[model samples]
Target: MPYAKLTITVPDAVWIGELSRAYPETRFRVLAATADVATGVARIEITGEEPEAISEDIRDYDTVTDLTVFESDERMRRVQVETTVPLLMTSLQNSGVPLEMPFEVCDGEMAFEATIPQQNLSKFGETLDGMGISYRVDRIQQDVESDPLLTDRQEWLLDEAIERGYYDTPRRTTLVDLADELDIAKSTCSEILHRAEERVLKDYMGDEKGARPTVAVSSD
Candidate 1:
């Protein structure tokens, strides 16, 4: 499957955009969003320099007729906010893309990273267009390696490695550091990394003859 990271900006005419503009200084990270036939709610984890002010502002928002805190600390606060933006979530959910974690909402844009079929890419875009939402594709990963070449665990580790700057020129972390972070032995981490690299290189160089790629489902 191919994966893409997209950032969608809601128009100012929309309720969510209005709220975002109202609270320009507050950062709202949507943890989860769900909708029913008539109503929708979004669990937002908010964090900013001024927790008290941010909390007050959220309470003042008319759109969030109901708001309740889940947790609060010095740096971050979580809350369930009744939203008028459930339609946006529903649109994406029905777009035939398997949403991955780490969904984000900050400023006036919602950022989503998901695994999608290459063929459905156009359909996904069309869905957004049908909803009148503006968006941009931040990144895309096409299948350069054979399917199942790396186990889910291996793929996760690779993602972590790239995120933590392990592949940087100066190297943000050593293999030992990565192992410590993963709570695994350095040797095991090394083995997994080496094997993953070998498989990826072989596939990229077209050395794996008779390799078959998985067909992805259409967005429709």
Candidate 2:
């Protein structure tokens, strides 16, 4: 398998791209999306100071036939909409690459991480190019099947840590914060994350010397 991370600049003609450019500060997290031959549906979490206004704007797009707000607050709004299929998504479908869901779009760019068949990598790139979708491959690595690499709890905790930026440079969140969020003891959280990280690193690096550098999971 091949694992890749891609950043794509959405064309302004697309509704989501136009909206992202209009409100550069807003973050659109597409939690779920599906498309068929005639229509597409997307469930998005819009986060910003004026999510209400943004939701209103989404309803006004000609391609959006229906928009339903499921939740709203001062900083975020969750909405589902029926609209035309996005070209980027169509390209992915054509390329036979499965997208990892819950991707983010901000400042007119969308980020995607996917694990695909080794033979499909070039086809994926070609499909994107053919659709006129501008994209940059952030990274591509040979990967093994990851499903059996970690326990379910370990995998869930790792996802939480990454989503909260616990692994980011300079560290946006601390181990203590993560533990608090998960309602677990700090030591337990650290232990689980450490074990998960070790398993992932070992699987990825194998016998490559110096490839498995220590990761400090604690920022207390």
Query: Can you give the lDDT of residue 107 in candidate 1?
Result: 76
Candidate number with greatest lDDT: 2
TM-score of each: 0.60, 0.67
lDDT for 72 in candidate 1 is 91
Candidate 2 on 26-97: residue-level lDDT in tens?
999999988765688889999997999999999998888999999999999999988885665677777888
Error of 1 at 48 (Å): 1.0
How much lDDT does each candidate structure score? 0.76, 0.89
Best by TM-score: 2
Clashing pairs in 2: none
Off by more than 4 A, model 2 = 145-220
> What value of lDDT does candidate 2 attain over all alpha carbons?
0.89
